[model samples]
Target: MGVGVLDQTGATFAEYLPGMRAVIIADENTWAAAGAGVQESLRAAGIDSDEPVVFPGQPVLFADDAMVLRVRDILAATGAAAVSVGSGSINDVVKNASDMVGRPYLSVCTAASVDGYTAEGAAITVRGVKSTVTCRAPIAVVAPIDVMAAAPSRLTATGLGDLFEKIPAGADWLVSDALGIEAVDWDVWDLVQGPLQDAIADPDGLRRGDLEAVEALSEGLQMSGLAIQVHGTSRPASGAGHHFSHQWEMEGYGRDWAIPLSHGFKVGLGTLAMCALYEIVIGIDLSSIDVESRLVAWPTPAQDRARVEALQPAPIIRESAVRASAEKYLPPDAARERLERIRRVWPELRFRLAQQLMPASEVEDILRRVGAIHHPSQIGVSLEQLRTKYFQAQTIRARYTILDTLEEAGVLTDVVDRLFAPGGYWYGRSPEPRWTDAS
Candidate 1:
């Protein structure tokens, strides 16, 4: 995790796969960044290895099911333990392949660009739908802080954007806790949330590639993944923000017409949207809810299924949405009780939610300063498409969140519509591009 720690790669690799051969997986860019040192380290540790698999760098590699199978076949044929040497996409491809072959792999991070470096599952695009395929975390992670802090602007910005996502994730957990749908996991909560603010506090410093700020960003991102690894669910780090990201991933969100978007950029824009939404959510007085009316208008299970069908995405994503929607639907009686809970806890819950979330404007400023994607259009997500996710994203995950809370209160549509209406918050904000590369 420190500077010049590529020297320790051999020790780390040996600790996990002693006497086993190393299978290096990297893209051209990452291989250039750290490949030579990794190969040299493995040999120094007396570990034999297969020739590194350096994929083309022209079109940045994607972690799709086909690529996973390709890498899995490579590893399976040689019977070597894997060593993934790239950021999110490369790591996910190798992680999924290693899991499929019944082996744990070590990760060598080229940049502080993703949480999945230490997360338990891989976010693989399967049949055009993004899914988190169950897999174990890397047995060992070797991140060079010096290398990360000196990496390109967009990469560090992505790390910061990924970490900022924890803010809204915490707020959503509060919603579920208040409604008594899912109890908060205090251990995981503290681990991910405790240092988030300080870590994201220095966007200017990070923009300048300052060592301390980058280190904080790096450590904070890894902790979020560690939470996922320990708790066995993305609940510790995902919320409506991730739902929005997942929606785009399924649709194959792109930087240009053909190039797919990075996970961090998707999450960054999603985090920005959710932060703005939270600003509106915290302002609404939940006590003003007309519970009796909501109970009268509450959807029956059949009606709930109908709504999901109407808003559902295609095939695989549709299947998940249907199953999740069915699992979380509540009867009129249960809806009434939940509405009552909201009315009772509205004040305190709002306070907690407000405390937990950063303002949308503040988050946007940080994003801009750090050179991350600060607007939806940068990722080719139109305001209308962004608007649809507010509803579509809710159906795909049964996990209780503010989205579910707003629905139970019978105001989800109203609140969401209000966000895009003229003169409303998030109505007309267009951010300019900063100094960032296409990659």
Candidate 2:
């Protein structure tokens, strides 16, 4: 129900869920790192704990069906309350599995890696498509500063990437509100924006693994989870950036690369892309927009499906993309109506969006300071790949974002091309030449 940020390990768990038998869930590495200590602490608090369920691998755990069932089976057999002892994947798996068993669980965060720890939904992959499955939040969150600060620096950097996304995520929310799609809840906005700014204010310390900085990052992430819980949606914490990440994950896009990106790492790159796109959106003169001409140029479903398939993503991803496109693609009249609304509110919308987002350069600087991957190249994604297919990410989600805005305005292609042009944010960073034309 609430999070407990603490300096001491193991002891805090007792205070939250005293005298209950628990089954600690962790991966091999986490069990060695903190799971064992957590078990010892539970004993000291007069709580009985079954032997920790340790999954094999140093590879990041995917919150998929197999993993969830495995954890659920253990909890069912043991009949003990669950205690997740790692970050992100572990927490999601345990949270969902605990919900399935109708048992309350506590989380002992091992890293400041993601904002899902205290959220009411678990991001899991079901049959190759990534989705946020509704689940109960942990009854209590036990985040020990020392454990989080000492976590692998990459994990912390990943957390920073996730935190940085709040800027563009909030901007997307503002845009959706302006379009009369989804209203922005200022209370939820207030919950995440301030903490995100505070975390970025001392990026150097966070990079160096300072306890205070790590704790701040952890608290901010926890608050983000709480904001989602309050809104009953991920709107406050996710947006176009997350959609991009989900697409990549569904396709196994970066798995074979030298450096596979984590969920937050991919989102960070998507965040940068969204911020750059927002810059373009702000400068557009809606008065010159010709909605009728654009509608005539819109691709048919077959043509769009061919474009998505050309990218050679997984079959499931391609199917999902086309399906979403069908739902999101607008007719000329609908497009004109949406464009008129945008035009009417351009002044207020521009001001609010600008206020909600940090400049892309500032976000990139913070990512660099925290040693996070800010470019697609770092994760082995070609510029052409992103330019050609990134818009499909928007189609895969019903959630409206800046991508949908551009699509509705019939300028997504032009904006994407500009993002790769000379002097653009991604220019000269790609290993290959830019696309010759917007096409």
Q: Pick the candidate with the highest lDDT.
A: 1
Model 1 ranges with Cα > 4 A deviation: 255-259, 313-316, 431-439
Measured with C-alpha atoms, the lDDT of residue 191 in candidate 2 is: 93
Candidate 1, residue 59: Cα displacement in angstroms equals 1.7
* TM-scores of the candidates in the order shown: 0.95, 0.90
- What is candidate 2's lDDT per residue for 240-314, written digit by digit as tens? 888778878777765544334678788887888888878888878654567668667767767766765665466
Per-candidate local distance difference test: 0.84, 0.78
> Where does model 2 exceed 4 Å of error?
1-19, 57-60, 256-260, 295-313, 430-439
List RMSD in Å for every model shown. 2.0, 4.7
lDDT tens readout by residue for model 1, 1-439: 8778987898899888888899899999889889999999998998888999999997878778999999999998999999999888899999999999998899999887888888999988887677889988889999988777777777888888787888998899888888787789999998899878878889989878888888788888888899999888989899988888787777665634443456777788778888888889988888889988878788888888888888965776777888998899887777778888899999999999988888888888889888888877666567787889999888888887888888888778889988889866668866344323752
Best candidate (score: TM-score): 1
Instruction: Predict model 2's lDDT versus the native.
Output: 0.78
